[model samples]
Target: MGEGVTVSGDIAASSDIRIDMWSKLGSRVEVGGNAYLGEFVTIDGKLLVEGDLDVGKEVKIRGGFEAKGWIVVRNPVPVIIFLFLYIREMMRLGKGEEIEKAVEELFEDSEDSQDFEGKEPSENIMIIPAGAKISPEVIEVAGEADIGSNCLLIGNIRAQTVETGKNLTLKGSVYSEGKIIIGESSTVHGNLFSKGQVHIGRNSRIFGGIKADSVLMHENARVDGTIKAPSGVSFLREAAEKQILVEVNALGKGIVSKARELPKGVLQDDLIKAPDVAEIVSLIKSSAKAKNGFVPGRKRKTARTQALERTRRFTGARTYRKEKSGD
Candidate 1:
C-alpha cells in the first residue's frame, strides 16, 4: 500500500509486499513476489526479494540487498556519472561514432574492475615527480594540483587549485579558477590568472602579467609585468627597489591612485600613465554593439532615434520658456 511500515522482525511474504510512496521500513524486509519501493524510503536492515525489486527516488539501504529477479532503479543519475556521459557524448559528436565505440571498447573492462588495470586512470590530483619532464601543451586536472620541486611542466595548467613546489619551472601560463600558490624560487614564464586568491612565495618570479581577485606577494618576489586585482594586493615585506606595475586602486587601508603623487619613500617607481581616451571610447562602442546585438544599418536608425528624442526635448523646453514669458 501507499503507506509507511515499521517492522521489528523479518517479514516473509508468500505473495508480495509492496512498499510505496514515502514509506519507510525500520528492520529487515523480505518479499517472495515483487517488491516495489517509492520515493524517500529507507530500509535499515537487509532487503531480499525473490521475484523482482523496483526502487524510486532517494532510496537508502543501510545493510545489503539480494534480488533473484530483475532490479530497477528510477532516479536522476549521480553528477559523476553525468560528467562521464557528457564527455562521451561530446567525443561522439566531435569524432565519429566508430571512434567512440573503439574508445569504449578500450576501457570497457574497467567498468567492473575496482582497481585501475590497463585502464586510463582518471585522477583529481596530478603530482609531477621531481626531475620529471612533461611537455604537454595543456594539463587539465579536475582537483588540486601539485608540481614537485625541480620538475619542469612545460605547458599551460588548468586546474581547480594549484600548488607548486620550490624550484619548479613552468613554461606556459597558469589559469586556475581557485587559489594558486607559488612555491619559493619557482618561475612561471607566462601569464597567471586566478579567479580566487593568489599567493606568491618568496624569491619567486613571474615574467608575465597577473590577474586575480586578490594577490599576496612575499618579499623579493619579482613580477615583470602588470599586476591587477579587483579586491586588492598586499605585500608581506617590502623589497628594496622593487619595480613592478601595480594597478593600485586601493593600497593597504588607504586608497591611492596613479593620478595623485605616491608617498615619497614608500614606493620607488613612477608607473602612472593617463588613460587613453580614444581607446576607451572604442572599447565602449564595441561593448554597446555586443550588448545590443547591433547590425550595421540598424545602428544608424537607433542613433537617429536618440538624436530626434534629444531634439524634441530641447524644443519642448524652449517652448515652455516662451509660454512662461508670455504669461
Candidate 2:
C-alpha cells in the first residue's frame, strides 16, 4: 500500500509515511517504522517514532518529542533549530534561576545533534538569537548579517561583508574578507580579523585586537587593544607631527622677517669693527701683562701729561701773565 497520511489523530504506520507537504498530527504522531517528508513540511504537534525521520528540506516541529531513528533535516532547518534552542535558554536565564547545569546539558545535546546530522547550509545570511552559545564552526555569510543581543558564538564568522548593529555582541573572532562596518552601540569581545577596511562607529567598544588593511575610527569610538594596519593609519584628532610642522613654519617665518628688518650695511660694519675692537683689547691686555699690571697706571699718568702740554700750547704765556696780574 501507499504511505499512510494522518491529519488530527495518532499515525500508526507499520512501514513508512512519505509526505509531500505538511503533515499535522494534532496529538501524537507515532510511526512504527520510518517517516519521510519532502520540502516545506510542517509537523505541528509531538512526533514519536520507533524509527527515523528524514526530511529532505525544511521542517518545523512546534511541539518537541522523540525520534528513535536518525533525524535528518536539510540546510535551513538546522539553522532554525539552532535559533530556537538559543532563545529558550535565554528565557530560562531571565526568570532568575540557576541555568548553569541545564545549559551544559543543552550544549552537549546540541553538539551531539550537530555531529549526527549533516546539512548543506544555504549561502544566505543566518541570524543568531540572544543567549545562544554555538560551537566552533566556520559560518560563511554571503549576504548581510545581524546578530541579536546576548548571543555567544564560539567559532569565527567569515563574510563577504558584515554590519553589526546596536546591543549585539560577538564572542569569537570575526573574519571578513570584505569591508566590515560596525554600527554604533555594538560590542565585540573577541579579536576582529579582516582583510578589507574596517569602519567602527561612535560609542562602540572592541575589547580585542583588530587586524585590517585599513581602519577608520569615528568620533567617540573606543578600542581597548592594539590595531595593526599596513596601508596607513588615519586619526580624527590632529597629529603631533603636523602641529610641530606648523609651529616650525611659523618660527621660520618670524626669523626671516626679523633678519630682513635689520640693515645689511650696519650688520657688515659691525662684523668688520668686531675684529678691530678685539685686536685693541688684546694688545692692551698684552701690554698690561708685560708691565706687570703697571701699564694702566702709567697710561693714566701719560694721558694727564699730554692734557697739560696741550693746555700750555693753546693758552701759552698769556694765561701765565693774566694769572700773575690776578685778572
Candidate 3:
C-alpha cells in the first residue's frame, strides 16, 4: 500500500505486503510472502512473515517479529519513487509496452484475487471507482462499502454495510451487519444477508435470495430466490415521497408504521436530507391537497414545452381538416 495507510487490526496478505513510510500499523501483521516496510514505520503488535523481511530506518515492531526467510534492515525505497525509476529505465531502453503491461497487471488485481478472502476486517474500506479495471475477488471490509455506478465487481462483499449506485454489475453476494441499499438498475448475482433492513431500488435484479430484518423493494425489482424478513416486506412502486404519501393516506385511522420510526441519522445522506415523517403525518392529519390542475407527486413541465405540445395538436387537426376538404 502507498503512504498514509491507517491500518487497524491484523493484516494478512497471501503475497507481498509492502507499506510505505511514516505509516502506523496498529496491530499484528502476517504475510505469506515478502514484507517490505518503509522508513519510520511503527507496528504496535507482533509481525509474522513467511518470507523475506525488508525494513527501512526506525521501523519499530514493538511486539517483535518472526520470519522464516532473510531479514534486511536498510533504507527501503518508497513505492512511488521505485516506480518512477523503473519507468525511467524502461524509457531509456526505448520500451513502452512493458510499462502498460505492468499497469494492466496492477489494475486487474490478479494478485488480489488470491487467498485474501476471509482475512480479518482491515478497519478500512476498498472503494472501486466507476470504470476501474478490477478482477473478481471476494473482499471483506470493516466499514461501509459505497460502490460507484456502472462498475462491475466480480466478488462477494462482506462489510458493516453496503450501498451501491445505479447500473452496477456485481457477481457476488453481499453480507452486512447493517442496512443494504442498492441503487436502481443494478444486478447482483448472489444472495444478500443483512442484520438490518434491505432496500432494493427500481428495476434491479438479484439472482439470489435476500434475508434481513426488513425488506423494502421496488415494484419492478426481481429476486430469483426467496426473500425472508421477520419485520416484513414493503413495495414502493413510486417515488419515496409519493410512497410516503400513499402510506399516510392509507392510514385513515392515523396509524404510523413502526418501520418509519427509525432513529434520526440512521438513514442520513450528505446531499439529501432524511424525510421528516412526523411532518408528513401532520400534513396527512391536516388533509393537505393541491388545487386546480396541479397534481401531487408529478414533476411540473415547462411552460414552453406545454405550449409546443398544444400547438402540435392544433396543427394536426388543421392538417386533417384541409386534407378532408381537398378530397
Candidate 4:
C-alpha cells in the first residue's frame, strides 16, 4: 500500500486494490470490484474495473482501459495516438487498391464530365462533409472547397480557395491560391500558406505560422506562431512599433523629430493621443488587432440585430405587394 512492489503475473482482487507510487504490475490488473491507483503506478496490461476506478495523475496504462461505469482520462495524447494509428490501419487494409480503381474509373468517365478534351479539370471542387474522418494525405482541388465542421483531416490540402466550418481540426498544412476562411474553434496544427487573404473566426487556435497576403482575425483568436503578410500590413505593424520607439524616446527626454511621425498616407483619420506608456502599448496592441479585422469596441450581436432591423425597415412588406391605389 505504502511501499513499492513488483508483481509479474495478473492480480485479481474481489474487493478494491490500491496500487501506490513506484509500484509496477507487469501483467494485467483485474479488479472484480473497484480500484484506486496512486501516482507512478504502471500497469503493463489491460486494466479492467467492474466498478468505479479512481486513478491519480501519472498512472500509466500501457495496454487498454475498460470500465463499466464512468472513466476519466487526465491526459489525452495516448488516446489520440492510439486512435490515429487504428484509423490509419483500418484505412490501409484492402482500401488502397479499391480507392485507386475507383479513381481510375472516375477519370475514365471524365470525357462525359464537363466535355473537356485537352485542358486539365480545373473547375472540380471537393467537399468534405461535417463529422467526417479523413486520413492525412495529399488533397488537391482546383476550385473552391467547402469543408464542414467537426471533421478530422490529417493531410495537406491544396486548393484554389478554401472555406471551413466551425470545430474543424486539421493536422497538416493548407495552401490556397485564393482566400482562405477558417471557422471558429478550429485548429490547424501545421502552417497555413495562402497567396491571398486569410480570414480566421473567433476562438480559433492556430498552432503554426500563417503566411498570406493579408490576414483577418476575429476577437479572442489565437495564433500560436508567426504571421506573415504584405507590405501594407507590415507597414501598420511597423508604425505601431515606431510609436513605441517614440514613447521610449519621450521617456528618455529626447527630441522627437517631425520626420519620425507617420505619414498621413498611412493613417487617414486624426491621430489619437496616448497619455502614457501603458496607453501607448495598448494603442499599439489595438492597432495590431484591428489590422486583423477585429474591431475593439464593436459588439457583434448588437451590430447584427441593428442590421437586420434596418433591412426589415428598408424592405417593408408593402414593396412586394402590388401598389394598390397607384396601380
C-alpha-based local distance difference test score of model 2? 0.60
- Order the candidate numbers by lDDT, best to worst: 3, 1, 4, 2
TM-score of candidate 3 against the unseen true structure: 0.38
Question: In candidate 4, which residue ranges exceed 4 Å CA deviation?
Answer: 1-135, 231-327
lDDT of 1: 0.72
Best by lDDT: 3
Which should have the higher TM-score, number 1 or number 4?
Answer: 1
Off by over 4 Å in 3: 1-137, 239-327
Q: Which ranges of candidate 1 are over 4 A from the true structure?
A: 1-135, 238-327
Q: What's the C-alpha lDDT at position 158 in model 1? A: 78
For 1-327, candidate 4 gives per-residue lDDT tens digits of 443555556667765566666667778888876677866778899999998888867888998888886665455468568756755675779576665565476459443356333433332222232222222365555566678777777778878899898999988888999998889899989888999988888788899999999988875678888899983232111123323323345434434355566765656244544444442233323453354455667544567897999899777766756466467
**lDDT per residue, candidate 3, 226-317, as tens digits?**
99999999999765432232133444433455565545554433223334445333332222354345455665778899799999999999
* Ordered list by TM-score, greatest first: 3, 2, 1, 4
Candidate 4 RMSD to the real structure: 29.5
Q: What is the C-alpha local distance difference test score of each model?
A: 0.72, 0.60, 0.77, 0.69
Which residue pairs show backbone clashes in model 4?
136-154, 136-155
lDDT of 3 at 244: 33
Q: Write the per-residue lDDT of candidate 1 for residues 1-327, one digit (tens) a residue.
A: 344533334456654566665555567878777787877778888998999898988898887889999999987458458757766787768866766676687559643354333433332113232222222577666567777677776778877888888898999999899999999999999988999989999999999999999999997899999999999999888544543333433222323355654566755435444343231122223343555545444444577888999999999999999999999
